[model samples]
Every structure is written in structure tokens, then in C-alpha cells.
Target: MISDHILLTLQVLPILPTLAATNLRQRISAFIHERTYQAPPDGHVKNVIVIGGSFGGYQAVKRLTKTLPTGYRVVLVEKNSHLNYVFAFPRFIVVKGHEQNAFIPYSGISKGALEGIFHHIQDTAMEVTERFVELKSGARLEYEYLVIATGSSSKLPSKVSSTESKYAQQELRGMQDKIRQAGRIAIVGGGAVGVQLVSDIKDFYPEKEVTLIHSRAQLLHSFGPRLRDLITETLTGMGVTLRLNARPDLSSETNTLKFWNGDEEMYDLIIPCTGQQPNSNIISTVSPASISKETSHILVKPTLQVMDDRYPYIFAFGDVAATGGPRMGRAAMFQADIVVDNIQQLIAGSRNLCVYKPKFWFEGAIKLTLGKNRVALYIQQENGQEILVDSNLGHEDGDVKSQWAFFGADAEELETRKI
Candidate 1:
């Protein structure tokens, strides 16, 4: 209906306003930056580099970028593309298809929200020095301050391969496939993971014979006798065969497990949920003197900094660093606050080092699910004693909702602050 020139003008006219608005926004931003972030002749902008992007690493990066003032660069290097919500792992496996919900894209947290200052490297950190970090791809990044939030690796044979997204998912798939072919399931190690695995299997597959073997005399030795007795009673009631003070002598074909009590048993599927080792190799490579060979964790000062006076700029947190306390996720998150605070203080040219005192009440509460719609909550006391608390709720009850909410809330918080 219109001439060619008129049609062209009308189409291009819409784009003009967008360009004008974009230019106006840019001009406003530039003017605001010029007024607020103008550096003096001697003032130099410092850079803060964060290594690792898992649980503790994500928290450290998020808190640093959110709290640190303008004129700072924060670099986050992580090998994984997506941040996994591992706490919900056990429940995800029991269901048919909930694997996607367990993993959140790391890109959800944009750089602009992180103070217009964030760099993400999708590579493993090969080494970390006082001033630079070397990536596995042969790229070296320089930084003013470094935070090591590297967590620990799961134990193998008992642990599913990292190739799988969630440990529970892998276990679920393996169990679904193996249980059909397996006549009996033998789980070694009486830790939380092992006990939880047994519960999940017995709850879902009632016909399957599940036996849990542990080297210790009772379950959860660290939780004290009362709590341990509760766990033993719950597992026994769930139709789980408990092999106490037993060790399995592993063989290739037969897969025979032998206990110290001269008892031998054969298993169709053997899973060992023993322990995990910290990924402290990066710290050890830089400063071996700061780590204890016996504990395999770096000794950290009260300020969450590595105990090396030579390199005051380096800090470590999470499971990789031993803060004279038990290594747990709650502890790591608490330590992340201290790490971020100390980092902020250092950046502001303040020498005031903050001390991190562990709290008994906030140490962390453990909730273990027994097969028969019951869960045990272990509350720790100030005097290092654990008390057993119990709750009864099935899979469809509010307890599951609360459990997912707790894990999802933490995961969402981390994912939102990720850079």
C-alpha cells in the first residue's frame, strides 16, 4: 500500500529509537562510572582470582563478587560446565526421570550481575602459585589474591564414576540394571552414603536381599553409641542385613567379601562406601609445607588463610583445608563467610584478621532416611556429643518436601550468585 521509500523509512524508524535508547543508557552508565570509580594516580585496581566452582567454590565466588567494592576483577575457574545439586542426589535416583532437575546451568549467573567483573574458565587448574594459576590447557592467569575452594573427590568402587552427573543417579541406574541380574547386593562401609544406599535399595526393591558390611562394630561410630544404636535398630527393622566388624577380601571374578571374624560371603553386586580423599594436590604443589601428610589437608589459620607466613595472599577453605574441625558442607559454607570477610578486609587495605570459631549448634544436623518412612536426625552437642532425634514420614509426606526445599534453596542461592 505504500511506496518503496516510505516502507523502508517506516521499517528503519523502529530501529532508530532502540539505538538512541542504547546510546543514552551507555552514556548514563559511563557518566556514573566516571563520577564514582575514578582512580587516583597511585591507586591501582586489584584482581581477585577464585579457583574451583563446586559447592564451597561457588559460595566463595558469589560472596566475593557481591560484597567486594568496584574496581576489582574476579575470575572463576572450574572444570564442569554446570553446577550440580548433589544433596538431592539420593532422591533423584529413586524416581524415573529427575536427573535434569539436579543440575543447573552455570550460565544462569551472568557477569553483569557480578559487578561487571567476572571471568569463567572451563578448565582444570593444574597448578597455583603465589601470583598465577596454570590451567590444564596450558594457559596461565595472574591475580592479586587467590581463594582455593576445591572440595574432595569421592571414593571409587563404592562411588560411581564422575562421568555420571549425580552419584545417586549412577547408583540408581546401576542398581536398576544390576539388580535384575544380581541375586544379592553387598555394600561395604557403614558411612552415611553406604547406609543411605542400602535404605534406598530396600525401600524401592523389597524382594532384593541387601547386606551392609562395615569394619567397625557399630554404625556411625562418630555419632556416639546412642545414635549408633538407633541407626542399627532402624536398618535392622528395614530388613537390611548388618555385618559388623567385617571386611571384604575383594576378588575379581567371584567378588567374595571376607570378614575378620572368619566369615565369607559372595555378592552379585559389591559396593564400597568407605571414605573420600581431598583434592589438595593443587595446594600441595604450591606450598607443601602448609599441608599435613597425616591428615592430607592444609592447616589453615583462624582467618581461613593457609598457615604459611610466606604467602599471606593465599587462602583455602572447604574440605581441602583443615580448620581443626570436622569437614562438612555446613562447616565449609560457614568458613566461606570468614574467607570472604578476610578477603574484603585485605582488599580494603586493612590488616585486621578475623578468627573463625566453630559453633556446636550450627555444626550441622544429619538426617538419615530409614527404609520404613522414618528418618533419624543427629544433633551434636557443645561437648562433642550426638543426640538421636527421629521423624516418621513417607516419600509423599511433607518431610520430603522440606528436604527438597532445603537442598533446592541452597542450590538456587549458589546458582544465582554464580559468575
Candidate 2:
């Protein structure tokens, strides 16, 4: 059997060289291009503004910068100064000293000669009109085409609630200290965040009594039965009290949880991993018909363009779009590809455009960490058979440095890196 450390290395080894070569190439190109590259006259340039800098928006901006024709540029307006490593949040909030690494610099997003083709605006987009986005800073950006990948929002640690890296670091540290002091902790929600958080807390502080309460019968309701069963076994074995089909009454006071079944649990701390609301308010007023009445997610057609035909140039994806699939980073990246392609086609005055098919089974791939150095990877085969690989191959910091380098971000100087 391959050792756990070796298995972990095997997963990360293939990408290291590629990242290294790409980083070196970008650095050299940036040095030369920054000096030689000249911008077009303002009147000649057409802007394709991409809102949000998370996975979907990031992927869209990266592709747009490379594929856009001359006279067109990608303007990314993202509130966060850094590209947050959201997957590492569950671990970073539990493990100390690695919180600062969760935020990666966005400077490398426009690597090499593409630097001149891209612009990053670190500001909140308050509203979107037919041809302009109003920023909270009172600046207006006019765009020929708009890609809204606003993603989702939740409480801290589930999603970092800060726009700056320094504040985000403090958010994680505060959560970690809270978890450290709590003797009886209750995690509400059985989603990926809840499962990962409960397990990590238990693994790191075995002495603390941790309970994961899910309103549904299954932990991950969207996943297949095999993986769900395995997760149940793993969490049970870790001594994490699983309260399935358990709903915590919201009226309960602080440090105490009450259930409709007349059950009560005392906790020093209660963390809610539930309620991930889409950040779709920017376009809600401008294009009310584009928003889903049910999910409040921006409605997108199969082509990834806004459902309302009046705004065909507008595209939405990620957790904020009703893609009829699980809200995941992988799916967002896939959708971004389609959004970029279609926008490129439209820019070239072509009626032909790409459509985004929701490949959930494939894009739904997830890696869940059970405990310190313990992990589970879930994927579906071609025939729709689910496969779960349970292994002790996770890192305490969730390999934050590798992710930073993946974005071509410098680990030594993340705090001061400009957006």
C-alpha cells in the first residue's frame, strides 16, 4: 500500500512543474510587457466587465484576457482584494498559524503580456444597469458586455466576511480562538462546510464535545448513498455526535439549542453553516425577470446568458446562478468557460454561441477532510456509479501554499500584494 504521505504527494506532484513553468514565463513576460505594451485610446476600447473574483469570475476574466481581440479588455470588479482560498477556510479556522494563507493575491491573474489586457477594481458593485455598473465608490464603469458571477455569501469561516486580507486573517483567528475555548460545540448544517468543520474541530480538539446537526436525513443530501454511508461511519467513528433529521429552533437563545422534538442541548458555542444566500442583488433591480423567484439565483439559459432576452449580453454563473446543479467551484469554472466563449462569439458579430450543459455528476466532484490528515474524495464514473476514496492524505493547513502558488501568488508577500 502506498503511504498516506506518498498518496498526497502523488496528487500534487503532476501540477508542480506546470505551475513553476507558468509562473516563470509570466514573470519574464510581465517585466518586458510592462515597459513596452501601450494601451489603446479610451474611445477605441470596449470593456467586458466581469463582476466578482471568485472561481467563476476569475476563470472568465483569465480566459477573456487571453482570447479578447484588440480594442477589447476585461475589467474585473471584485470587492475582495485577494482571491480567497475558500476550501481551506474549514481547516484554517480550526488549525492556527495558517489563516493568513487563505487569501491569495489577484496580481497574478493578469500574468505575462496579458497584464495590459486586464484591469482589477477592488470595490463593491452596488448596482448594474443595461450598460454600466455603479460602484459603491461612486464610480461608474461602462461595459459592452457584463458577466455577473457574484457567487454566494454566508457567515464567517463558511465564507470570509472581509474584503481585505488582514481583516480576513483576523476573522479566521477569532473563530479558531472561539473553537478553542468552547467545550460543547454545535455545528448546524450537514453540508460540506458543516461536515468538514465538525470533523476538523473534533480532530484538533478531541476533548471538546462536538455535534453536527442536520435537518435532513442524509449529511450530503445531493450526493449518492455510498458516499453518504461512508461519511456517516467516519464521523461516528470520530466520536462526532450526528443528529440527523434534527432541526434547531431559531428562537433558542445563545449557547443553548432547542429542537421541535422537545430536545435541548447546551453548547458553549454554536456555528451555523446553513443558509448560503446568493449575492445577486446588484442586478435584481435592473433585471427583475432575470432572477429566479424560487432560489433568488440569477436565471441563466443553457447558453449561460441571462434568461431575459433583453439582456443577452449579461451572463451569470457560480453559486449565484441557477445552473440546476450543486453550487461548487468546479461547476463554476466549467460555466465560466461557456460564458467566455459565448461572449467572444457575440463580440465577433456571430450568432453562433456555445451552450453550457450542467455536467453535475462530473463537476460535482468533492474532496472532504474527515480529520487531521484524513480525507475522502468523491467522484462519479461514466455510468453514474459513485466512487469514494477514503484516505489519510489531508494536510493540517490543507496545503494552502500549493493553492497560493496555483494562483501564481507569492507566499512571502501576500498581505501587501496589490489587487
**lDDT of candidate 1?**
0.68
For candidate 1, lDDT tens digit of each residue in 186-262?
Answer: 87889877787787777777788999988889788877676788878777887899988777775445678766667
| Residue 355 local lDDT, model 1 | 86
How does each model score on TM-score? 0.79, 0.89
- After best superposition, candidate 2 residue 93: deviation in angstroms? 0.9
The CA lDDT of each predicted structure is 0.68, 0.84
Candidate 1 runs further than 4 Å off: 1-45, 93-95, 155-160, 163-172, 250-254, 384-387, 394-419
- Report the lDDT of model 2 for residue 264: 85
Among residues 3 or more apart in sequence or in different chains, the pairs in candidate 2 whose N, CA or C atoms overlap within 3 Å are none
Q: lDDT tens digits, residues 138-252, model 2?
A: 9999999999999988986678878998999899999989999999999999999999999899988999999999999999988889778988988899899999999988665
- For candidate 2, give the lDDT: 0.84
